[model samples]
Structures are given as structure tokens and as C-alpha cells.
Target chain A: MQKEKPYKVKLSIMPFWSPLTPPMGIACLKSYLEQNGYSVRTKDYNAISSLFDFGGRYIALMKSYTPVDRMGNIAMVGYDVLMAHLIAYNNRDDFSLNDYHELVRQLILNNFFYEATDEAIENLCELVEQFYALLAEYLINDIKEKDFDVYGISCYSLTLGPSIFAFKFVKKYFPEVKTVMGGGIFADQFNSNSLELETFARKATYIDYFLLGEGEIILLNLLESNFKNVPRIIVSDKTVKKVCLDDIPLPDFSDFDMNSYPQLVAYSSRSCPFQCGFCSETVQWGKYRNKREEKVVFELRSLTKKYGKNIIVLTDSLLNPNIDKLADALLEVPPEERFYWDTYLRVCDMAEDMEKVKKWRKAGLYRVRLGIESGSQHVLDLMDKRITIEKIKSNLQNLADAGLKISTFWVVGFPGETKEDFHETLDLLREIKDNLYEVDPHPFYFYPSGQVDSESWEKIYGYESIYEDKYNEMLMCTYYKLNCQPCREEIYRRLELFRERCEECNIPNPYSLIDIYHADKRWKKLHKAAVPMLNDLIHSGSAIVDEYRDSIVLR
Target chain B: MEMERKGIIEVLAAIFPNQTIDIGDDDSFIDKLGMDSISFVSYVIGIESKFDIEVPDEYSLPSKLDTLNKTYDLLGRERG
Candidate 1:
């Protein structure tokens, strides 16, 4: 009574990046493919030793400099790797595949944190020599085993380097299979950055197709009809608008190794409703949309049943527009079965309601990350953040009273922000330091898709250069050489003082995970247990250190 | 409380389980093993937890943990 499934595809989440959360886009595509009666397989190669083992080694080395946290240590090491390549590149305007990979290969072998002696470098390279062969063999066998017609990869800012490595592996070994690349990184990158496309895209010539916008529909169209031409790169003349959020199926996470990630990401909404000039999130997501409350509740219920009491982070934009209905559905989850969760929430008069805040906390809302943006009303208006300081202070009190942790994000170094305006952030920090769980002040970055800021840079102001001169488009690290009021140095000093104030007020100045256990008498014991468990999961190579005896120092 | 060879190896293996360590009790850690100053502190933490000893501030220096045999003697001599 069942139709035979013939189509096979391999969706891969590459390594040397964040292991705190699984790639939700890949999981969504897998679910869609299976529902369409296609055989789908995934390679969460991020779980392997090549990435995690390297993190463990680097962490062990860097502990003397400063202690790294249990979460996001992998990404920390990845940036260090990227830095080594940048140093080797030495601002070269031209590059070749052989030279670039040679630098990467040199990094994998030696100078993880620092330059190694000849003997140590030799030992390190010999230890990882098996890794190169393993990657090639793995890709070849997987393509043959799955009888894969297509391979998809998920790329983000930090993953740009390693994703290319995986791309190369597929190109060299399984060249016949069609390679498709799609993720948040490529959404708006295809537009008018033709110089970026020309230089960056040509290096990766093996890729047959690129799906733009929401990946689910684009991927379905490509695989279902064996179609390659789409509104991507220069030649394609089609760009698909995103389907409504309710149309997307619950992500099939069975293909992922959940043990490798620090927390599970449960999606509820997409894009941000507010068009703040500072963010490029809308460029990737197109428009704001929410899944039906019942459908969202169903996804949560299934996830909870599978992984009991795991920390679930809602990977949504600035705020969920349907906050009330989302809370109502969360109430249906049994208290014991309920998972601890957090999401970005907007601050407004309605959010300041004490009764609603209490209800949301009872439904397992442990933390709420607020995009306060700036403490000064003038700067908030300039950035088009449609909220008031009074509303935020009021809601901060309400959320704290409901026994919920607060993570307020303040963006410093905004265009036209004066020193007097930055002091307002210090004033706001002093007001809520005790009640807050964390206060993160992010530096302003110039992203390619940030229209208002880019216009202000050249037209309104005289900031000439945008990104790094060489390989600007391909490398996604967003930084700018801006000539602005309250220069980066002054912003840096004020942030240091703000950090000191947080420390004085006994607040943890961390943006990663937070806990209410800090107030409990048994907090120390609970923290000790949680740290190792979290550390093991986020850096998975600890499990197989014995297998690769030369990689670590055994007594 | 004399330290045992098996216990030290077990603790070291737990921390860095992948490497083939050539142990010499008298060989300096910097000389025999390729570990740096930063990695030694982690080994000290393992030492403290495994042997039920508090590694004093002075014991944290690489000079104190220089040799395998000297380190074992120091551990057995200064148990907590």
C-alpha cells in the first residue's frame, strides 16, 4: 500500500563552527523531502573529531590565557583558524585553490594557538594524516551508499571556511552528483555584489545550483523536477518568495546527532516584523510569518517526548508577533514534560503587564533576550527601533518579578551616536544591573544588506570603504573602517567600565547560557555536574580521545 | 600515602586519552612530553581531583612538575 521511494539526497552540516545548536534549515528540508516520498540522509560531520577534537586541544592550550566557556568554544577556535589563514594571505589581492588549502592544511597540523616547533609540528601532522583520507573516503562511500542525486550544504558566517572544504571533498570524489548550496549566508549575497559573485563563486565551480530565499520550496522544486536554473548567481533570473511559516513542516531532527549540540533549537517564527535599519535578518527571511499555534505546540510536544527536560532555545527573530497564542499553547505541555526555553522578545507597554509575564514564566519561559538596542531614545529612533525606554524599564521589572531571567542587548557605536548617548546606556545598565541575568553590548557592524546604514556611510557621511579589500564578499566577517562620532576606542573604554559595573553588581557578564540555580543553595553542585555534561556534548571528541592516541598527551 | 603508577596514568589518560605518552618518572614534562605551561595547569587539576590533593600555588609551576619520577615523588610526598 506504500509507493516506492527512489530519490536520495545528502544534506550536510559541516564542521569547525558552532555546535551549540543544530542547523534547523537542513532539518526542515529533510522533513519536506521525506513527506514527498524521497529517501533522505544527512551527515552531521560537525560531531566528528576533526572539529571537536581540535577545539578540545585549543581549549586546553588557551586555558592559561583565559578560561573559555562550556558553550561556543568550537566557534572560538574556528575564528583562530580563520585568523591564521588571513595572516598567511597577508592581504593578497589574488589567490588560488592550492595556496588557500595549503594554508588550511598548515593550520590543521601546527600552530593551533601558537607556532609549534618542528618536532611538535611533525607529530601533530602525522596524528591528523588519517583525517584527510577519512574525509575523502567518507564522501565517496556516502554518495554511493545513498545513491545520492544531490548534496546540500548549510553555510553561515563562521562555517564559510569548512563548508568549502566539504565542497572540495564532494567535487573531488563525487563529482557526478549535483551539489546544491543554500543557507542564510547566501540569501541576500547574490544581489548586485557581482564582484563578490564573480571572484567568490568561481572558486567553487563544482556547485551545480544554489537555492535562494526560503530553502524548503527552492529545494523541492530543484529535486522534484531535476531543475538547476533558479534566481541565483548571475545567470539565473528567478527568486522565490518565502512561503507562509505555517506551510513548513516540523524539522525532522532524527538525522542530526543531538548529543553533539549544547541545546536543541525549536523554531516558532521566522523573520522580524520591525524593520530596524541596523539588521540584515529580513534580507534572509524576506518577511515575518508565524506557524499556527497548534502546529507549534505539536512540534514542542514531540520534541519533549523524545528528549526529556533538555534546554530548548527558540531560534526566532527579534520577537514572536503571536506571543499570547504561543503562551496559551505552551500551557498545554505537562509541567514535568515542559522544556526550559528562551527567545527574543520586544519591549512595549503590553509586555509590561505583570499577569501575562507570570503566565509566560509558568509555561517554562526561563529567559527572555530583549533587543533593547540603545538606552537613548534618540538613537533608538535613528535605528527605527519602535520602542520606548520607559516601556523597557517597566517590562524589565515585570519579567524579573515573574522569576524570569533577562538578557538585554545594547548596540553600541551606532551612526550619529554621541558620547552623551552612550552614557545613557551606562545609566540604563546601572538601573537594572541587579535584576538582570546578563547585559551584552554588541559593537555595530556594517553588513552588505544594511541599506540605511550603507546609505548614511557614503551619501550622508564620508566613510569610504565597506568590507576588507580582498575577498570581501566571500568572507562574511562584517567589519568596517568607519569615520564616526564616539570612535571605536572610546566605545571600547565605556564597555570596559560597563563590564566592571556588572561585576560589582554580582551579575554574570556572559551572553551564552544562564541559570536560576545561582540563587539556590545546591547551585555549586548542580553547576559542576552541568558543566562537564555540557562540555562533553559541545566538544564531542572527548568521548573518543583514546581512539586517536597521538592527538592528545596520555600519561 | 604513596602514589601508584596506575592511578597517575589513569588520570592523565582521562584528560588526554588520545596521545601515546612515553612516561619517564625523572624526565622533565617540558623535556619528555611536548606539553606547554598552559596544558600543565589542566594536568594539575586532574592531579588534584584524582589523588584527592590540593595543588598549591607553588606546585602549579612547571618547575615543580618537571619530571615524571620527581612529580610522582612530589605527589606522594605532599598528599594534600
Candidate 2:
């Protein structure tokens, strides 16, 4: 008998977020590897019951070493601080009812903020120490263990701090395991020249390989070549250039436990055509290119067959450009199977094809999220949205007529948006309120590129800085100069006005609009206040806040 | 079976009066009801709210909710 494949690759994808299943890239790679006769096993570390298994072990050890009563007091104080940070973070984002509860539970055991400070940073180190200790113990106690040839850790720009700790821990304990890094965060950095390359390069000591762009193609190539010097990153090598989307395989959700998620996510296309000033799609994915329509249909049908009829969320930048093709494909599927779906579509498409809009209703397209960036024509033009007030009104009305729920994503502070322009947006919203199911208005985030050049940047923020990696750029804050006062104040006024309007109309703010400014002001008062609170909560030994559990939102 | 078909038609009529609700016993939901994902979900939610019946996780619209016969069976199962 032929000997079983020599290499048994135990692939693991761990994301800090709940649904940390391997993305399409990993799924495609899995399929490719399996087809080529490599024994592959993928574990979603995100789904493992205890999010803070490492942290919890540390706490237990600490408690055992110290007096039980003193440890209890320390744990209680830590828990209180942790709860405060959880409350503050959740309040910043409008979390759903269920998400808030889950976040609280996860926070109790998992130290999400452990990496926020140097003191708490030690806790993370201890946690990792315990994690490896437990892993070794498990291998000895449970069954015969074989070493994994390569261990890959996925990282997003936002979660870089925690990721670094996790990477270091894995490398320290399992020195034999080849550590590789890949994902959107790295891909974004490699594609755009704007990212902080020096910082990444300095931090590269821990990572063995940074598989840039679509990792499936490069990773498989690297693995098949027996870890030979391939085009992709091979520690101490220059970054590999970006790859095309066509090269990647369709993502497999089969390995994931889908029941944990509330919504089913599907992608019809990659990238957006329009150059919206605030969006990073263009910078990241390059120009828009859709997967073959048949591929999307097959994926949808397969998912429905496997998961039963579930809500399908189209994770496309714009669903309207290929609306006809999508509508045709959806029509082929039974309506019951297509029960509910949501997608972002351009307003222009809706205006052109009202009948198709109606057909979408027939095809079970429940929600259409339109990016009505601003009501002012000037602001809309400035953002390069290429839509008019008339088109928005007509498209919205048509959708309503077809019995489809409409959700509008509006931005309050475009660089040139005057107070009067904001009022116009409110007026526009009021006009379309009857036709809409919800309205989400965010303060304009001055992303690194688009219409905002050096002059525009200086005019808005009184400073000009080029974004090294468009993905990692700090875009959470708004910067603009009004006749007097700060632009953030103007943004707040617009948000307040928008909230007041929603209240007057008796429409519930799904995002808890008040929390935006509340959290913003709290953070602005003392920049480090929230960070320390978060760190304490993550390092805390017990559960803390529960009253405002329903208020926290995670995106 | 006729009674169940009538119940399904009644729900569809409430949502879409302009469109005709002529569907064969063997007809598909998308081809027959002229409903898409959005309307199908709205209709499902509406039925659940109106009839006070819980739709099962496995029940999909148009395809599964297509035939009045299948819907009636699912509804009975859910209600029971």
C-alpha cells in the first residue's frame, strides 16, 4: 500500500472576531491542497468555546500562587475596569442585542484589551506561556501528537497588536513550526505604497513569511515547492507583489460552524467601480472584477443546499452593475430558498431599471443598502459618487413601490459640506423617509486618498501626510476647518440634527446614533483613558458590566 | 390541500394586490408568485407576525415557500 502523505498540514485561522472561519482565500487553498493529495485540517480558533483560554489559565495560576481572598479582590477591581472598557467600546459602535451579550461573556474570560498597556502586556505574555504549557499537556494527556510543519496566523490591521502577541507566543513555544502571516491587512499593505512599511519591517522579526495578496496561489506554490524560495515572502525577502482575484478559488464555508453566525455572507464580485473619496475598495482590490455569474449561482445553490434556506448577504461593493445577471440567477433559484438577501447597490442602477427593481422584490431581495453619501449635489460631486438628488428620490420611490426595504448610508461631513448642505441632506432624508426602512449617517472619515489632495488635506486637518498603506491608515477621526471651531464639532451638530429628525419621525436608530458622539467626546477628553480601561478589562479576573449589555455593537 | 392553498394565496394577496396569484400545484415559487428575496422575506416576517406562527430555520422563501401546498405543510408543522 502507498504510504500516507508525509506532510500532515494542520492549518489554523484565528481571528479575534467571532466568525473567524478562514476567508475565501484559505478555503480555496484548502481545496487546492486537498485535490493535490496533501492531508489538510483547518481549525477556526475563533470558534473554540473559551476566547480567553490563555488568559484564564494565567488567572488560575496567579490565584493559586497568591492568597485566594486577595486574588479575589484584585480580580474584582480588574473586572470593574474591564466592564467599563467593554461598555465604552460597545457604546462606540451600535452593536445588536445579541452581539452585546456575547461580547460581555467573551470579555469575562478573554482579555481582549490585554495588549493595550505594558503592564497588561505582561499578562498577555503569561497567557501565551500558559497556552503552550496547556498545549504540551494536552498532547501528552490526550493522544499521539505529530508536529505541524507550518502554522499560519491571519491578521487584520485593527487587530495587529494582539496578533503580534499570538504570533510571538506560537513562534516561542513551537520553534520548529514554520510561522506564516497572510490576510487582507497584509494584502492591503503590500498593494498600497501608503502603509507604514518601516514599522511592519521592524516587527517582521517574529513572522517567518508574509504571504502578500491572494495567499492561496502563493501559499500553495510555496508549499508544493517544499518551502523553496518562491515569489511570495520568505522571511528577510522583499514583499511579493499583489496577485489577481481570478487566480483565487471560490471560498469554502463547509469547514466553518455556520450556526454561530446570524447572517450568511456571499460575494458576487470583488472591488467597486466608483471612486468614492472615503472608501478603500479602489486602493485595495484595484478596479472592479466580478466572478463569473455561474460561479456565484453555483456557490449560492451549494450554500442553500448545505445550510438550508438562510438569509444571503451579498458582500459586494455594488450589486447593481450586474443586477440583470444576478436577478436572472436568483430567479432560477426557488423563492423559498432565496427567502431574504441584502446588498449595496448604486442609486443610478435603481433609477434605470425600476422593473428589475420590482423583480428583485419577487426574487427575495429584502434590503438594498444605498450609499447616498450626501444630499448636496456639490458634496456628492466632490465624493465622486456620480449620483443626483433626483435619481435617489426616484430609485427610492420605485423600491418602495416594489415593497422592498431601503437603507441609506449617509456621510455627514464631506470636506466642503456647509451647515446648509447638511440640512439639505436631512431634508432629502425626510423626503425619502417614508420609502426607507433605516438611515445610517456616519461622520465623514478623511481617508488617505480620493478627492482630498495635499491642499485639501492641509485645508481640512492643517497637516498633510501621505498614507503608506491605505488599509492601515488611521481614518477613525474627521478633520476639516469651518468658519470657526473644529470640524468634528460641525460633524456632531449634523449627527445631532440627523438624530433629532429621526426622533421627530419616530424612526428607531439601529446604530444608537447618540453613542457615537458620547464615546467620541469621552475618548477626546483623554486619549489614553479608554485604552487603559480596555487593557484593565482584558486583564481582569472576573465578569464586570452587564446592565448596558444590550447597547454594545460590533461590526 | 385546497384550504391550505387558499391560506397561502390570502397571505400573498395581502402583500401584492396588483400582481395575480395564479400558481399551479407543481409550480415553482419564483416563476409563480413573482416574488424575489426582499418580498419573500417581508412576506415571511409578515406571515409570522400576523399568524403568530414561527417559521422553522430550514424554511426558505420562493423555492420552499413556493407552492401553497408546501407552505401549508411547513406552516402546519411550525404551528404544531
Candidate 3:
């Protein structure tokens, strides 16, 4: 009567991730496994976390984009503080309350935040422990519900610590269930020598296997081979040929609660052709590859029909690599079948193609997120972001004219950036204020391993020194010192100034809420009066802390 | 108190003209009336303008002022 299901596996992503859309990584893996005829299930703890009263607040922070500067991000600072305590507790059996208090004290001393009292730190530690147990209860209950053979946890940059916590739960509760870990975090951490990957595997004994690079092929290989003679850390590049975008099955969102998210997530392309110096996207995805336009259109039609959501968010690096062809393919679909989409774009000759852009608009390209890294040509050149300022301005005007919302990002405090260069960025913001829908300003972070040409950038700029803080076995922090103008303090001042300029220009930055909360904490650090004021603000039922409840419907 | 309640209903009606005509005082803005985040913010602004009272940013949250009764209660505290 029914076909027998084989090779039962459950793939999950842990909490403290964005609930705005379903995770694309797990969805892709789930689809690939099903296509290969393996029974697969997904546990989206990240999405489900929004249902809890406390987890809802965390999800809200996770949903908002944080700048590269961790201290400036209320979300990042809060997450890192809790994670530092959790990791330390996990490592030591005799870890005491004082250890957590000391750990938080170290964080405060290291300039992670302005200040926190001993009592506050103690209370926060208790709350985090309770939250972890609650998350584990949910995880264990789901695992117990079905006898899954393999449990895979997808680890992103933010979810690394939580995923480790999840693996511990799986090993403790269901020891027989094989634990596997994979995602962008591995892509960032894995080095050329394989030494780092080896060290990570040895340290995380709970994770039986690590699927590096893309998961679809390696995961299927592991399942088929029955985990025999497979390396504990299976690097995708070493194991299988680069996956053809055309051959891979479309991402399966059927496993996810599609109604919970505002927009459905899909990506037509793998990576960007342009190798910007400050970018790590190309590192994660080796080379640029795209599906055939026909396949993309088909995916659109099928996904829209199945999900009943017309607004699709493409997680592609840049959707306009082959703009003309893609636009034409989308236009081939009739008006009714076409669905609304938003994607990242580069300021290339494609923007100058007014007719093609109009076709893209007609074909449901409602938003274009542009990495206008800097308004200054000098900084742009230094970052190896080839697009010129003149071109950026023209493109913004063109896209805005075509009824596409131009969400532009600017980087503050790139190496060698001067006061005048910073001013040029401000001037550009003012110039394009009318055309801009949202302006997100982020501080420049230099991840030596992640960048394409950090050596060249460092040599040319004559940076003072690079500092790496290996806080624990798991977390490694990196900080760069600029020998040239605009020190870190000045850089932060510029970030605040950038926000002020946005307000003066009347640009509606949805991220302003998080920034305001961050500023309040900074003010608390500076003034005693700010302590009472902060308490008042928190007790007043402010949306900054309480709005997470409104972001999603309670399950 | 009755007049304050009427004023709150009038403000809600102005913000969401079509939805508020037959809305019960206990109807949740989000659940019963199907108000989104933006409309909720507009309703807050509408209440502030109509009643000539400044609603604190904290109290303006949808969870805090989701119903006419809640808005009426908030007004009593503000007036006091």
C-alpha cells in the first residue's frame, strides 16, 4: 500500500538564529536526501524558538542584522556573553557561579560591553541555563518521538555554541543516534592544512562526523556508505566534485511551517563572480554558479504554487550576474504567475540597462540590496570593491526610478580611511537619500582567513598590528589595529554620526531600534543616572525588548 | 470613564476605519481585528493625536495596547 522509508535521518538547526525565513541550508539538504530516496526530517529549533516567551526576545535580536563590530551590536554582545559562560560550564565539571561571574567580568573588561553588576551576571547565568534545558527538553522530546538513525545539526557563525550544546544533548539522551555537524562555520574555520578541522573534530567528541563544504553530496555519501571508513571530518571538496546547481533538487520547504515566515527563501545562484577583499561569501561557496533560467522560473512557479507565498527572498550573493538573460527568463512567465522577489545586487552595467531593469521590475524584482561599501572612491578601491561612486549613484537613481527599493549598505572605518573619506560617505548618503529606501552602516572587520587579499590590504595600509583573543577552546576573537587615521573610537563615533546623518536625511532605518538599545547600554556605562533610566525603560514595556512577541504568532 | 472609552473607540475607528465599526472593546488588535505591526503603530499615533495625550514609546507597544479596554486603562493612568 505504501513505499517503505529507509535511512531515517533528522537534520536540525539550533536556536538563536533568524526566524524571519526558513534556513536554506537544511532545506536544501532535506530535498537532496529525499531526491536520493532517503527518508529525512528537519527540526527548525531556530524557527520554533520564536514561540517561547524568552526565546522570542533572542530571536528578535537574531533577526536584526548586526554590524561587524561586535561590541556595538547589542545582539552579538548579549549572545557572546551567554555563549562564553555556556562553553566554559560545558568544559569544566567544577565550574562555579564565581567562574561565570569572572567570565562575564572578563567580557566587560575586554570591552564587550560597558558594564554589568555581579548580581545581574549571576541572574543572567541562571536564566541561560534554564533556557538551554528548555531547548534540550524540546530537542529530546522530538528525537524520542521518532527513532531517527542520524541527527545532523547545522552550525552557522552565531549558532556554533548552541549547536555544540545541542550535540551534547543528543549524545546524552540518545547515545545511539549518530551526531553530525555542518554549515558556514566550518567553511570559515576549516583551513588549507586541515589542521584546524582535525583539532575541531578531536575536541568535539560528541559530533561523530563533520560535513564540511556543501552538505548535499557529502551527507548523502555518508548515509549511503553507512559511516564505514569515512573520515570523521568529511570535507566536501576532497570527497565529491563541485555540485552542479542545475542538477541539485529545489530546496524543500515542505518540512518547514511556511506560514510562520513572512517571505520564502530561495537562491538562484551559488556565489558572486566579483572577489571583494572584505567578503567571505566566495570563500564559503568556491566559485560562481547559477541554475539555468528555465529551472529558476520553474522553481518560482512550483514554490509559489505550493507555498502560497508570492514574496520570495533570494539569498544569492548577487542576482544580477547575468542580468539580461535572467530578466528575460523571468519575463517569459505571464504576469499572474510571476511572484515578488528581493535579492542582493551589484552596481554593474546591468543597472544602466533601463529596459532590462524595467523587465526585472515587471518580473517581480521589488527590492535590490546593494553593497555600496563606501561613498568614497579611495576606500572602495582599497577594499577591492571595483564599482565606482559615480556608477553607484547612477544605479541607485536608476533602480529607484524603476520602482525597486534600493537598500544600500556602507562600511565605516575601513583601513586607511580618513576624516575626509568618512565625510565623502556622509555626502554620498545625503546625495542618494531621496533614492535610498534603507541605509545600513556596518563597521569594517578584517577576518584574515576569510578575506581574499588581506595580505595585500595589510601591507599597503601598514596596519599597526593584529590581535587575536583566543578566549576559550571554541571561540577565537580577532581585532585589527590601524596605523593610519581613524582609530577605533573615532570609527565608533563615525558610526553614530552616520546614524545621525540618516535621521537628518529622514531615512527610515528599521535597525535604529537596536542601535538605540546599544546606546542606552553605553550611556549606562558612562553615567550613574543612566542605570535608573535603563531600568525605567526596561520596565516600561519598550518595544525594543518586547516587540519579539509581536514579530511571530505564538504556536 | 465612559467618555474615555468612547474616545478610544473613535481613535481605533479612525486608524482602522473599516475594521473598527463593529469591534468589541475586548477584541485584540492583532488577533480579532487582524492588525499588523504598522497598523498597530498607526493606532497608537491615532490615539495620541485624538486624545491630545503623549503615549510613552514603551506603552505604545501592541502587546500593551492591544484592545480598547487596555487603551482606556492606559488613558486613566495618564490622566491621573
Identify the candidate with maximal TM-score.
3
Ranking, DockQ, top scorer first: 3, 1, 2
lDDT digits (tens) for residues B1-80 of candidate 3: 67877777777677666764566678777777666433555566577777887776445335567878788887887778
Q: What class would a CAPRI assessor give candidate 3's docking?
A: incorrect
Best by DockQ: 3
Alpha carbon lDDT at A403, candidate 3: 55
The lDDT values for all models are 0.58, 0.53, 0.66
Give one clash count per candidate, in the order shown.
8, 29, 0
Write model 2 residue lDDT over A1-555, tens digit each, in one string: 233455666555543433412244455556656655666665554443333233223334344343322222222223322322222231323444344334333332222222133334345344544444544444343223545677665656433434454556666666766667776664333333433433464445667777654555566666777766653354211244443444444555677665433345677776788776666665555557787777777777776556653455777889877766776777777634444566888898555565676566555565678888888998888787888888888888777655555667888777778877878887877776666656666665443333224235545556333212221222211122333222554564566577678656644433211222222223323222121121122222133222211122212
Steric clash pairs (candidate 1) = A231-A238, A549-B18, A549-B19, B25-B68, B25-B69, B26-B69, B28-B66, B29-B66
Candidate scoring better on lDDT of 1 and 2: 1
Model 3, CA-based lDDT = 0.66
Residue pairs with clashing backbones, model 3: none
Ordered from best to worst lDDT, the candidate numbers read 3, 1, 2
Between 1 and 2, whose TM-score is larger?
1
Docking class of 2: incorrect
Off by over 4 Å in 2: A1-25, A36-40, A43-147, A186-191, A225-249, A334-339, A447-500, A503-555, B1-80
Ranking of predictions according to TM-score: 3, 1, 2
